[model samples]
Structure formats: structure tokens, C-alpha cells
Target: MGRRAIVLLVALILAGLAAWAVWNFLDGVRSEAEAEQVQVTVYRAAEPIAEGAEGGILLSGQELIVESTEEQVDLPDDAITTQEELNSVLTGRVAAGPISANAILTRSQWTEVTIDVTPLAELIPSGKQAITIGMDNIGGVNGFVEAGDRVNLIVTLDIAADVIPADFPTLPDQETGGEGATGEAETITVTYTRYVLQGLPVLAVGRNVRLDEDAPTVIDVEPDPTTDPGIEGEPTEEETGNETVFTLEVTPEEAERLAFAFENGSMWMTLVPEDFVEVETSGVIIDTLFGGNLLDDIFQN
Candidate 1:
């Protein structure tokens, strides 16, 4: 019980205090690690959900499977965290697009199903009439053109001199000295291509029609396998040989021009962007094509 004894006791007390502090620090670290590893229940698709499928179908058909994932996982902010949340969000909603199996269900993946069925005629503007044109894949922008796209039409016509009426006044042939020109002129065919229409709004593409501009186009449901057994497999867009049809909204005068082009000339559609600018284009014939300085400009660049 002297000075040395007192100093030894003080040292032991300090050592015990340091041990307690170290133990507490380690315990807090362990708790934090456990908290970070905590799991939360989430909903995932058990099978493929077709676009436009209702949210109620997920619960009734048991298409959603509950999965326990760490809260720290990269889940979407609107991720369905509980069965109650899923039911609340999906009651009358439909999938925005095709949801693959095991995809985490999120609020952004579904949207309110539009109940009002808009008629096709109602979609066209008052001043516009819908005109449909059919073409091969190559001429139809390789079948990549959609209903809401804007397109420009280029028409190629091969005009033969014989097709002109006999009574039509004719320029005297300089080579034939104007005498032989009185009879039917020698048959000559000239091919020319011109941009006939620009910035035409496409109303529909093939069988897929856009009823509402804001809403997603309703996709046709797949034929039930039980009813038709002849279908081998769904053909990709590239594999199908069917002709692509584009329905455009145009004025009555424009429709007549389009009909003339469709009947007597080959037409090709060029896809244009929403902010497309119409530029003045001179019709192209063989003489103008070869006479232009386009080759010089290309090489100079």
C-alpha cells in the first residue's frame, strides 16, 4: 500500500479501460457489417410476361416469385419491396414491354392500361386522309420503318416515247430533217427519279397500327398453340417474305400524286427524323446525273 502499489493499480485500471474501448469498437463494426448484409424481399417474374399483360395476372397466376436480396444490391428506386407494394402498384397496370423471366418487378415497368379504345379514323387529323402503300423490304427501308416515323418518298419513272398520244405535237427531229418526224417518232425510253413527297407522317406499318401517339402500340397476341398446330416457329423480321405496307396521312391532292407514282413508277421510302428539313431537290435524269460536279466534290473532300 505504498507509492509503487498505487502506481501499479493505476496502470491496471488504464489497461482494463483500453480493453473495454477496443471491445466496443469491434462490436460496433460487426453490427454495421450485419446491417449492410440485411436481406429484403423483392418480386421477380417467374416466367416471361408479355407486353400489355395485366398486373393482376402476376399475383393470380403466381407469376411473381419472392426473392430475398441484400438491400445494398443495385435495386431500382421503384423496385417492388413487398407483396403489398406489388399489389398496390399492379392492380390495373400493364407491363410496358416484354419482361423476361427473373426480371425484378419495378413500378417503371408497368403503366396504367388505357381503357378508352380509340377508333382508327379518329387518329387521323382533320385535313389528312390515310393512304396505304405496299413495297418490298428493301424499298421500305429494310422494314425498319415504324408507324410513328416520318418518311420521304422517291419515285422512279421510265417514260417511253411510244406512250405519248399520236395527236400530241412533236418537235421535228433534227437528224431526220423534220419530214420523218411527222410519223411516230422512234421509240425512246428515259428513266428519271425525283423526290415526290417529304415529311409524310406514317399512320400505320403493316398490320401494326398506332391508335394513340402517347400510348405504346398494342401488339397482336400470339396465336394459341392449342388452336393452330401448323406454326413451326415465329419468323424474324428479316426471315419473313411478306410485303411491308406503310399507311401515311396525306392531303387528297397528295394522295392522287401518290397513286400515280404507285401505279406507274417505282417508289422508295427514305426514313426521316422528327426535325427533318425539306431541301429543294432537282429531279434526277441520266444527263443531269453524269453532268453534275458531284464526283469532283467527292474527290475534293
Candidate 2:
């Protein structure tokens, strides 16, 4: 009786222990699976995102702690604002400055450098030439042209006005002197005049032009082609003109018009004051349009 009882009690106790062990293992696994993951909530505006926008998303960058003040950014109407959208915005690269207000972020936003390809114009076959703020061989300084000035280009055709001499008849030398010979007659040919037409305003000032020997003469500069450079940061304005000698800052659309005008007609940089109102349509034709001509045209028109 004692041996049977003792063996039965030992077996029961071992079985109970085994069940408890199994229960504990299962409980541990469930707890691990339910554990919280490292996460942060990034704030994003409520707007759709562009396919390849200038900015969005913030990874490891200048951290901006959440404050009482509401963070803001400028966003287009169709910008995106969602975790998945944010991921896509940042897929190519992240830019500095507030992600567009319409952009969405998983956690927070980071700003990287931004790059903009603006439109500009340069002389063809001339390479890049610095825009000098001076005058030429005229009464006006640099033709009175400045960095932010505008003017019409008029070309003078002839150095001097055309003139013609008339022929004369010789009177009877026999009546006056008898043996004397008659005088001969002579005449001169007339000369003609012409002028070059003026082109529309196509050029804009891109920063003040300065003298630089390292830069090449501006032979050709149109508008920036790439809508999005896909780079994370924007180069400084000076950097944009690294290879450019004359960098004319203008709108993309305006760039097209300027390029067309430059190619179609004769374009000379004429300098006019900001408050200038008089516009000359007809005047003396010259290689460059001067202030005198502009004033004359305004009155004539």
C-alpha cells in the first residue's frame, strides 16, 4: 500500500508540473507578440501630393520638436497628406524647409536643401558673358542701361544722311567769248536709308552682373529644362551660374518668348529707367537704341 500510494502521488505531481510549464511558454510568446514597437507620429497637412514635388518627408535631419505653435508650410491644392504618400514624397530625396503643407508624414518632417531650375537667356555663339552695369561709346552711360532696366533696340543704317547733286546746262560760249569752249555738266547719285525693327521685352535681370574672368562669355543660355532636379538640396544663386557668365532670371514661359525674339530679330540690350513711360516706334536707326531715340519715338508715336 505505501509503495503504490507513493508512486501514484509522484506521477500526479510530475504531470501537473509539465502542464504548468506549457502554459507559461504559451503566455510568454503571446506577450512578446503583443509588445509595442518604436514609433513616432509625424504631422502632415491635408492635401494631395505631386508626383515629383520639390519637398516632403523628414528622415534624420534637423529635428524640430513638437511645440504649442502649429508648424506650417505652403502646399498646392492637389498635394498629398498620408503616411504612404509621405513615403512616396520622400522616395527620391528629402528637401529642407517645411515639407509642402499638403504633404503627409509618418512621424515628423525634416528639411533639406532645395534646388530650383529657373529660366534665363544668354547670347548664342557668345557663350556666357557677365552682365556689366556700364555704358558704351555714346552720350549715355552703358546706353543708360542698368541691371533692372528695359529699352528698345534701334539700329542706325547709315553713318551720314544721303545727298544728291543736280546737273546744270552749259550756255552758249560762242555768244560771250566766241572761241571759248562750253562748260561740262555733272551729277551725283542719291543714297537710300533703312533700319532694323525693335523686338519685344524678353530679358529680365538675374542678380546684378559683375566682372569675372573665370566665367566664359555667355554664348547660349535658355531656360532651365528639368522641372525637378531630384537632388536633395538647392544650390545657391551664385552656384547656379557656375558655368554661366550671364544669368538672366526670368519665368519659364517668358524664357521661351525671349529665346524666340533673340533668334527671330535683332536684340540689343537697351537700358531704360523704371519710371520711363515714353516709347519710341520710329527714330534714327543705329546699332543700339539711345535715350534720345526712345524719347523721339514716344513723341512721334
Candidate 3:
């Protein structure tokens, strides 16, 4: 071939090699893009999950859903991506806080199970004081009183003549057999039962407490029926413990009254409804109790 023709041929060969190289680079780029677009299986919450709820229960109940989604380029490093990882890491853990529905599961969302005991100070509302009272099963509503419940406190006390005012009028001494006879005053004792505190919020039951007004009480657990007395009418000491402590949220003045009643008078707790309305009570004494129509109404009914 001539020199000019050979130079042209060599130029064509070099151009072809450059084109092949560009094609190979483009194909590699396309492959990498496709790989990055592959779908990945991830876990997400199907329903709202309460804080401290078990992950396994959530998954089994379909509260947590598994979905296949395109791998996100900007996905978080701690995001849960695979079934194996979720089962190993999150199934045994609990949500660190309330998880909204459809939230992507992540390592930071869960934590190891821990006792959820709320501090007593945290439970007391602003401007309220926490006071605890110890009572038997009957007084504690057969161990049914739970934290976050509302209750009324009834106190029974004995009033003696010494506690009565000294200025009160006195009748003539009958034993002296004289009219308007001035002598030592006669002593008398009377028992009265009246409601001391109404609509008091319970702060804690024993050691278990509720975190917030909306949160479920941590100590509200159903008693096991198998352990309850089947044939015996009355529960034994082993079945119902001697005392259950009830922590109540009260004002400073109410706390003082409760302390006095707890110290000197018999106090009983009566669970009140959420919409309970306070009513003026006349209080019960021997005369009022016996003279009222309560007995007649009961027998008539």
C-alpha cells in the first residue's frame, strides 16, 4: 500500500479501539446503576406501637410489616434491611418510645427490655404532693385499686368529751338531785364516719406506677384464678397479703389531713368513678345511722 493509504488505515484502527473502550465504560456504568436500584426487604411498623412494647409481639400481631422497597441511596446506616437482621436484633427488644404507624424500623428505635418503673416524683403532678397509705385487702378494694385510679377516703374517728369545746351548755346534774347545779361536766364518747377526701388521684400502687395520664398502669395485672381459693369463701393470708400500699396525689393541706387520719383514725379507700361528683355528706353517727330510713329501705327492698 502507498504511505498515505497506510496512514489512513492506521487512523481508522485507532478510532475503532477508542469507540470500543467508550462502549465498555458505558456498559459498566449501566450495570452499577441497575445494581443500586435492586429491591431490598425492610421492616416497618404497620400500626402504632406503645413504648416498651415487645417487638416479637408486635411482629406476630402484624403490627410490624415486611415490605420490599427499592434500596435508597441516602438510607440511614442504622436502618434495618433484612429479615435475618431484624429477627436477631429487634425481635427481642422493645421500642425506645412510641412508634408511629409505617415508620421504618431502625437499630436506634429499639432497646433491651428494662423495668419500666416511673419515679414517684415524676408521677406527681405540678402543685401536688404524693402520700402513701397502707391498708388491708378490703380497704384497698380487694387488691383491685391500681395506680391512676380515683378514690374517696372515708375516716372513722371517735370524738370524746375532752375534744369538745368547753363552752358548750350543760344540763343540771341529775345525780346531784338539784336544779341548775354546777359540778364537773359529764364525759361522753361518740363515733362518726365521714368522707375526708374526695376524688383523689392515685399516684402508685405498691411499687408499680403509671408514667402519664394516658399511659396504662404498670401494676394493673389480673390475679391468677388458679391461685385463688376455690372452695374456701374467704381468702387466706397467702392469697391476699396483709397490706397494700397506695400512693395518692394530694394537695399540701389534704396531705396533712390524710396524715392525721392515718395516724389516729381508721381510714378506708373507696374507688370512685371517673365522672364522680362530690356531694355534701351529713356524716354517720349512732343516732343518725339508727334513726335514718336506711334499715327500713333495705328491708323493704
Per-residue lDDT tens digits for candidate 1, residues 161-254, read: 7655574557667887674324443578989899999999998887667658576666444422222224346664534644388899999999
Q: Point out the worst 10-residue segment of candidate 2 by lDDT.
A: 63-72
Candidates arranged by TM-score, highest first: 1, 3, 2
Which scores greater on TM-score, model 1 or model 3? Answer: 1
- lDDT per residue for candidate 2 within 51-109, as digits (tens), equals 33334333222332121222233333333444466556555453323344434443233
Give the lDDT of residue 86 in candidate 1: 84
Q: How accurate is candidate 2 locally (lDDT)?
A: 0.40
Q: After TM-score superposition, what is the CA distance of residue 117 in candidate 1 from its true location, in Å?
A: 3.1
- Name the regions of candidate 1 deviating beyond 4 angstroms: 1-116, 161-187, 214-231, 236-243, 291-301
What is the clash count of model 2?
34
Instruction: Give residue 77's error in model 3 in angstroms.
Output: 23
Q: What local distance difference test score does each model get?
A: 0.78, 0.40, 0.76
Best by lDDT: 1
Task: Choose 1 or 2, whichever is better by TM-score.
Answer: 1
Better of 2 and 3 by TM-score: 3
TM-score of 1: 0.49
